[model samples]
Target: MLRLSKKTDYALMAMKHLALHGDRGASSAREIAEQYDIPAELMAKVLQRLVRRGLLLSHQGTRGGYQLARPATLMSVADVIQAVDGPLTVTACSTDDHACDQYTKCSVRDPLWRIKDRILTALAACTLAEIVDDTSVPTIPVTLSRRTPAPVTER
Candidate 1:
């Protein structure tokens, strides 16, 4: 049942968009929203969260829009998710000091927290640069044949 919030999803999408089209300068939330058919209001809010987190920089002008605060390679998915959503957790006790009544007796709590930490680390390893690079290796890449070239192609 673990899943990312809608706002986090939007934030990641916005970051990727900015990284890809950053050469064109900033991109208004409205433009990105329209491109992806996301609600303009929601997109604006998600982008604002990123700006507040210092993952993005907002501009104010006739052509005002948003841009990445740093290179995409420097921005981690975990950072963007944490900005939109407080933090990633697999259980209620992952971040809360006060746990459920069973907290003390729960045998699985510790293991679950470990899982959450690993997940977080994995997310941090992925950067906006990787997401926007659509040229990633194909799902099924062509491989070299093992057969020799027919005994040096005798005439």
Candidate 2:
């Protein structure tokens, strides 16, 4: 499964929160954390990383926190993911030399490459504003769960 790291997830959540609130001023990490039920320390670290990445601007002292360094509409989901998780490639071979033994004869390699490109492109096209404003439609997947029945109890 393609999953985002907890750090990335929290970062997205924090950014979304800021985007939703708009440019009223900076938001403290503690405030954002408490509002979102995230750990203050972890969120603070994520926010700091975002600041260093130029995605957010941080203010210090009493009435200080963070604000978007750029407009939310200008920030892409891929940007956020990349800032935290490095690259979005699903396979190790996607970014570097073919480490897989089947690379020489893999029939699915080309198609997989195409899929990765399409996915990254799509993600790049989507912006934080689109995610937080609800102005755009999102494509979410619905999975059915199959639960096994429990064994009969002993007499």
For lDDT, the strongest prediction is 1
The pairs that clash in candidate 1 are: none
* Candidate RMSDs in order: 11.1, 5.3
The C-alpha TM-scores of every prediction are: 0.84, 0.81
For each of the candidates, give the backbone clash count: 0, 0
Model 1 lDDT at residue 10: 86
Model 1 Cα lDDT, one tens digit per residue, 1-155: 88999888888888989998999999999999999999999999999888999999999998889999999989888899899888787887754575588877889988898988988987888778988985751243459899757666567
The numbered model that scores best in TM-score is 1
Supply candidate 1's per-residue lDDT for 15.
Answer: 91
lDDT scores in order: 0.87, 0.86
